[model samples]
Target: ENKAMESRLRQAGFPYVRTLEDFDFAFQAAISKRHIQQLTTMQWIDDAFNVFFLGPPGTGKTHLSVAIGGAAVDKGYKVRFISMDQLVSAFRTESTDPKAHRALRAIRKADLVIIDELGFLPITRTEANQFFQLVNDLYQRTSIIITSNKSFEEW
Candidate 1:
């Protein structure tokens, strides 16, 4: 049992992996120092960090995001994966005031929430506000991994 715990911790990567020998520098470039710093801090207390991956199509955004989330899960984090469309759709379906709040609460409960394919479709103003609220709720509290085909300026 002790060895199992140690093995899981080693699989978490990060401090266990001394160098980025296996990580792609290109993917590393996509990630910002602030996010890395936040992750480092989170390592201290089992907290999580928020990260955004924005670039053109086929830029390996999804791959890197998944890798990070996988690493977090290996480290024993409760990770939730969903596309932006799914998030919007889920909230749109339960347009009731109470259900919307419930969805928001669900998002807040995750240790890591990953949203992929953002900006794939046009979002209504209200949806945008709700999405922003979700972001704000998770901001600094839990980790978020966002991947988008559009550049930051376009977003």
Candidate 2:
């Protein structure tokens, strides 16, 4: 079990490790601790529900998403953490890049995917189409958690 967890954590691709216990709820008082506790249960992932964390930069969006993703990994779910830029880049070169192809394949097989830093960069039409197709394919199959600094209207 330890080895499996180590492998899963390594495969999850988190920039760094962060756990719920390390989160400063008092600093981000707007977030409800109880609600976050509920999320740590990971029932939403099991239901293939998508989670969105939208706020200005440095409001703990990535931190919360990473914490929840870490929890998911600990629970034995396959998880993948990719920045939005990285994902878009992978989509752009997936056809010719073996590394990108492998990354996409790993994402598809993950039970929970954490996409951080959405809306940080503008994407071309081709990239948008590729992203749409990937999301459509993951729909109803894998759960996704996205962290974006932009509002829903802006997106």
Candidate 3:
């Protein structure tokens, strides 16, 4: 059972395997290790609360988000990690296409999804609408960890 679970996690398509232990709190002093530890417990996921990691480049926002998502996966929850570009590309590829449906279905089924680099790419208003639709669909049903370089005010 343990082996199978490991295999499942391996195939879950994490951007990269990042763990809380691997994160360098010394380098990123602004981030609170205690907060990260609390997040690792994934209580937010149980309550379907979204986690937003907003910081400038090289601040380790991605590291924290991935670490948290990895924690969820380790606890036997399904997780999917993708960049903002990949998400927009998937949505812009033809709304009724099989690929789009597959992406939506995958997000729907995941217990936690890590959307990394959420403002790195330029998306059209239409694509933004579609993305919001996905967010709306997942609201209160699945948890998401969003890593963005932009602040909430910018968003």
Candidate 4:
């Protein structure tokens, strides 16, 4: 009975959710009255922000990333979910052709981008630059959620 009730409550607030616990922590962290008061007083507003979820595996990094993306989608923002491998593979495949530019534009135009599994394998210098370019393009234009298993030193 308790589980069913919780499910209904989550569905009421988040209709398109894949998992009810996805935004659990973020919602809690953001809704605290103390933090809300502090945020209201802040003057500077940036065009975009990067959220890095650095932790060991099975720590809900990707889950929270997806949840944030879902919230953005619900609010009418364009969102994209691409793993590091997929992004690099696609970029490399288009590297020698005119389509490379188009691939970059897609990443740039997204309002929210969820990049999962960073530092999964060794990346070549060329691949690293391509990743950096994508990051640069979205630096101040769109929000980014990056999930990484490795520590900052590895990056």
Q: Which candidate tops TM-score?
A: 2
Candidate 3: 10-residue stretch with minimal lDDT: 7-16
Task: Report the Cα lDDT for candidate 3.
Answer: 0.83
Model 2 bad stretches (over 4 Å): none
Task: Sort every candidate by TM-score, greatest first.
Answer: 2, 3, 4, 1
Tell me which of candidates 2 and 3 scores higher on lDDT. 2
Tens digits of lDDT, candidate 2, 27-100? 99998899989998889999999999889998899889889998999999999999989999898788999999
> What digit string (tens of lDDT, one per residue) describes model 3 on residues 75-153?
8888888888888878876456887668667878888988889887778898889889989989998998899999888
Q: Where is model 1 poorest over a 10-residue stretch in terms of lDDT?
A: 12-21
* Model 4 steric clash pairs: none
**Ten-residue segment with the worst summed lDDT in candidate 4?**
36-45
**Model 1, span 1-155: residue lDDT tens:** 55664554443322223222245565557655465445533472255556677877876667666666656655666566678887898778765667545655666787877788888778999989978988888877788888898877776
Candidate-wise lDDT, in order:
0.66, 0.92, 0.83, 0.65
Better-scoring candidate (TM-score), 1 or 2: 2
TM-score against native, each model: 0.67, 0.97, 0.92, 0.69
Clashing pairs in 1: none
- Arranged by lDDT, best first: 2, 3, 1, 4
Following a full C-alpha superposition, what root-mean-square deviation does model 2 have from the true structure?
0.8
